[model samples]
Target: MIGKVPKPGKSFGGCIEYNVLKKDAAVLYADGVRIDKVAHTIDDFNMQRKMNPSLGQAVGHIALSWSPNDKGKLDDEKMVEIAKEYLQKMKIQDTQVLMVRHKDKEHPHLHIVYNRVNNQGKTITDKFQHYNNLKFSKQLTLKYGMYMAKGKEQVNRPQLKGIDKLKYELHDTIKAAIKKVNNITELKKELAKQGIDTYFKFRSGTSEIQGISFGKGKYKFKGSEIDRSLSYSKITQAIQQNVQQRESEQVQHKQFVSDLKAAVQSQTSAFPQRQSTGGKSLLEVLLTPEYIEPMPYIYDTDERKKKRKKAKSDL
Candidate 1:
C-alpha cells in the first residue's frame, strides 16, 4: 500500500466533501464526527477547530491506495487497520478523523481527512511529513506481504483458451451487462444475445432458490466460481440498488425541471421584456395588473322641476 498526503486546507468542508461524496464511496471509519449527513460531518470538524483557532490550515487529507493485485486481500477492516497504523507512525494521532473508501478506480484506495488541531487545542506540525510518508509507506508494505503480490488482471487475455478463457469472457460480459440491466431476468435476456444462458438451482422439492449457474457452448460454471461479485445474492442486491437509484434520478430530474420552470416564470421580465409581453412580454409589464377605464354617468330630469323652470322663464 502507498500513502499520499496533500497540502492542508483552511476549511474542512471541501476536503470532507471530496472524500465522502463520489461514486461508490463508503465510510469505513470515523472519529469525533457525525456520519449521518455531509453538512453535519463538516460542522463536527469545524467545531473541533475552535480549540486551535489560530491554526490557518486545519484540514489534513491523505489518500491510501493499494495495488490492484491486493484488491481481493484488503477488505474494509484490513484497510482501516492499516490506515490507523499509518496515522500513528506519522504522529497524526488524537485528531478528529474520517476514513472513506472509493471504488471508482481499478485499484483499491481510500481517503483520510482529519483535523490538524488535536484534542488538546494544539496544532499538529506537518513538518517533514512527506519524508515520513515515504519511509512508513515502505515499512508498512513490507509488513504486509500479501499486498505486494502481482495484480490479478495483469495477464494477457487474447491468447487465453478453454474454460479459463470462457470464464474470463463471462466475467467481463456479465459485468458489462449488469450496468445496463436492473435485474437478473433482464440480465439473462441480455446474456442470451451473447450466446450465454443462466440457470438457477432450487431447493429440493421446494421453490426456494439456493444457487445460480451460467452456461455457454459445452461448459457450465457456478456463479461464485466465475467471480464472487457475480453470485446470485450480490447481483440481486446490485439490481435492486440500481432500480432505486434510477427512481431517485428520475425524481431529481423532475424536480429540476419544475424548479427551472418556476424560476423562468418568476423572473421572466429580467431579460428583454420588449418581446416577452404581448406588448412587452417583459417581467415588469407582465407583473403589473391590467388597467380598466370607468363608465360615464348621466342624470334624469323630472317633469315638475321642468314646469317650474318654464314658469320662471318669463324673465
Candidate 2:
C-alpha cells in the first residue's frame, strides 16, 4: 500500500487531492467523500439535479487505486473502519467521510472526500509527513493483515530487498569519498576508479541536495533514487560491492564543472557589497536636500592665537 499527498494543480482547480493505492479500481472525489445510493453517471447529471435540487456542481474528491495483490477480495467494511481510524488517529473529529464505489477497475475500492475545514470552523492542516505516514501504514498493515506484497522491496515503506542489502556497502563508499575529497572533481575521480557517476541536482529544501550516481551492471546508483541522506562514501562502497561500470572521464569532467560552479556561486552570494560606477557625483546631480543646511567650520591661525594670548596677558 502506498499513499501520496499531492496538492491538485490548477487543472484540478487548486483543491488538495489525497490518494492511496491498494489493488484494483481507482476512486475519485470532488466534494463530500460519499457517493449517493443511486450511482449517477454524467448522463444522469440532469436527473440528479432534479432529484436532489441543492446538489452543488463542484464536489471535493478523494481517490484510491488498487494493486494486483488485492485479488478482487477487499473488505468494504474493513476499509471504512480503517479510514475512520486514520482520521481519528490524526485527531480530526469534525471531518465528514464520503465513500464512493468506483467502476473504473477490476479490483474494488472507494473514493473518500473530506473537508479540511470542518463545520466547527476549525482548520485541519494537510501536513503529510512522508516518513511518519510510511511508519503508520506499516503498523496498520501488520495490525490488519491486509494483502501485503510478497517480493517487492524499496517501496515507500521499509521492506528489505536485494538492493537494500547492497546499500550498506554503498553507504560506506560515499562517506569515504566525502572524507578525503576536496571538491567534486576529486570525488568523481575516486568514484570513477570504483565505477560510479556523480550528479548534482536541487532537492526540495535549500540545504538539501540530490547527490551523486553510480553504475552497477545495468542499473545506476542515484543517491536520491537509492536512499535519503546517502552520502558519497556509502555510494562508493555500494558500487564497489555491486561491481558496475567504472566512472568515465567524461562524467568526471561534467561533475567537476558542476561542483565548481556551485562552489563559486555559493561563495559569491555569501558576501554583499555596494558598487560605485563612473557616474555623476552628488554635486553634479544637485539632488541634495536644501532644507538641511551644512555646518561651517573655523580654523585658528597663528595670528589669531597670538592676539588672544596678548589680550589674556593684558587682562
Candidate 3:
C-alpha cells in the first residue's frame, strides 16, 4: 500500500463533495458527519472548519492505494478498518473525517478527507506529515502482509500523472545512463542527450559538491526526490565502483599477456641453448662432410690373368 498526501487546500466542501459524490463511490465510514446525503456531510465539515477560521488549510486529504495483487484480499469493510487504523496512527483524533471507497480503478483504494481543524478549535499540525505518512504507510503494509511494490522499476510510467510521470522518466533515464558512464562528467554528458541537465549543490564557501539535481525543461528535482538510490553520494559510489572494476580487469589482462610472452620466450631460448650445448654448432653441422668408407678393392680380370700367365711361364 502507498499513501499520497496532497497539499492541503482551503475549500472543504468542494473536496468533500467530489470525493463522496462520485459515481460508484461508497462512503464506507463517516465520523462527526451525517451519512444521509453528501450535502449535509459537506455542511457538517464546513461548520467545524468555521470554528477555527484562523487555520488557512482546513482540508486534509489522503489517498491510500493498494497493489493490484492485493485485490480480493481486501474488501470494503476491511478497507474501512484499515483506514481507521491509519487515521488513528496518524493522531488525527477529534476531526471530521470521511472515508470513501472508489471502484474507479482495478485496485482497492480509499480517499480520506479530514478536517485539519480539530473540534477544540486547535489547528491539527501538518508539519512533517508527508514524511510521517510515508513512514506509517510502509508500516501498515508490512503489518498486514499486503503486496509490496518495488520502487520505480515496476511503475507504469505512462499511467503516472503530472510530476510523478516526469520524475519516474528522469529516474529511468538517469539510471540507465549512469551504467554506461565511467565518471560524473561522462554521466552529465550522457544525460544531456536526453535533455536532462545535471546540477551540483556545493557546500557553503567551498568547491565540494554536497548534492545533485536534474532538470528537464523547466522542472527540476533533487536526485533523492526522484529516487533515493539516485542521490549524489550513491551515484558517485556506483561510478567509482565501475572505474575500479574496469581498472582491475585491465590489469589482469596485461598480466596475462605478459605471462604468455614470457612463456613463449622461455621455450624459444631453451630450445637454442639445448642445441648449442648438446649438439654441433650450425656452422660445423652445415660445412662438415659425412664420412665415406673406402671402396672394397677389386682386381681387373685381364690384369689378374696376365700376372698368372707370366708366373706360370717363369716356373
Candidate 4:
C-alpha cells in the first residue's frame, strides 16, 4: 500500500467536489458529516472549520493507493476499514473525514477528505504527516497481509505525476548508475553526466556522510527516502561488494589460466602419455571432479563401552 499526504488546502469546496463528483467515485464512508448531498457535506466541513477560524489550511486530504495485485482482495468495505485504521494510526482523530473510492486506474485507491479543524475546534497538526503517512500505511499493509510490492517495477510510471514522478525518476537513474560504477565518486560523476546532482549530509563536524540526497530539475529527495536500499551506507556497501566480486573473479581466472598452462606443459614434457577417462582430456577431467557421497559416520555406543568394561573385570 502507498499513501500520499498532499499539502493542506484552505477550503474543502474543490477537494470535496473532485472526490465526490468524479465519474467513478463512490462514497464508501462518512463521519461527522452530512451525507445527504454534496453541498451539505461541504457545509458540514465549513461549519466545523469555523470552530478554528484562525487556521488557514482547514482542508486535510490524503490519497491511499494499493497495487493492482491487491485489486481482487480489496472491496469498498474492506478499504474503508483499512482507511479508518490508517487514520487512527496517523492520529487524525476527532476530525470529520469522508472516504471515497475511485475506479479510474487499474489499482484500488481512495481519497480521504478530512477537516483540519477537528470536532473540538482544535487544529490538527501536519508537522510529520508525510512521514507518518508513509510509516503507518506500510504498517497497515503488512498488518493485514496486503499484497506487498517487491519494488518500483510494479509501479505504473505513466500514471505518476508531480513530486512522485520526480522521486521515481531519481530511483531509476541512481539504480542504473550504481550498476556501472564501483564507488560514490564515480556514482556522482555518472549522475552528473545525466544531469543529476548528489548531495551528502555530513555527520556533525565530521567528513563522514550520514545521509545522501539526489536532485533533478527543481526537486530533491533523500536516497533513503527514495527507498531504503538506496541509503548512503547501502550504496557504499554495494560499491564495495562489486569491487570485491570483480577482484575475486579476476584472481580465479588467473589461477585457471595457470593451471591450464601447467597441464599443457605436462602433456608435452615428462608425462606425455596422459591418462584419459572415457577419451576425455586430462585437463577436462581435472577441472570437473566427479561427485562421490561419503559413507555415514558411526559412533561407538555406551553399551559397547559397558560390555568392554565388563570383559575387563573378568581379566
| Candidate No. with top TM-score | 4
Q: How many clashes in each candidate?
A: 5, 35, 0, 0
Per-prediction TM-score: 0.47, 0.39, 0.68, 0.75
Q: Order the candidates by TM-score, highest first.
A: 4, 3, 1, 2
* Candidate 1 structure quality by residue, lDDT tens digits, 197-223: 999989999988788899999878788
* Candidate 2 runs further than 4 Å off: 8-62, 90-92, 129-131, 150-237, 243-315
What lDDT score is found at residue 303 in candidate 3? 90
- Output the worst ten-in-a-row residue range by lDDT, candidate 2: 8-17
- Per-residue lDDT tens digits for candidate 3, residues 141-181, read 99989988877566656667666678778988998887788
Worst 10 residues of 4 by lDDT: 268-277
Q: Ranking by lDDT, best first? A: 4, 3, 1, 2
Off by over 4 Å in 4: 248-315
TM-score winner, 1 or 3: 3
> How well is each residue in 1-315 modelled by candidate 2, as lDDT tens digits?
433333322211222123323333344332333233223232222232333333333223433434546645456666666656655655545644455455555544556555444544444555443334444555665676666654333233333234443554555576677666545567778877776666665577775545566555555556643454455455445545433324465577678767766665566656442433238442222333442334676646987899899999999
True-structure lDDT of candidate 4 = 0.88
Per-residue lDDT value at 168 in model 3: 77
**Minimal lDDT window, size 10, model 3:** 269-278
Considering only N, C-alpha and C atoms within 3 Å, which residue pairs clash in candidate 3? none
How many backbone overlaps does candidate 1 show? 5
Superposition error at 314 for model 3 (Å): 99
Q: Give the whole-model CA lDDT for all candidates, comma-separated.
A: 0.82, 0.48, 0.84, 0.88
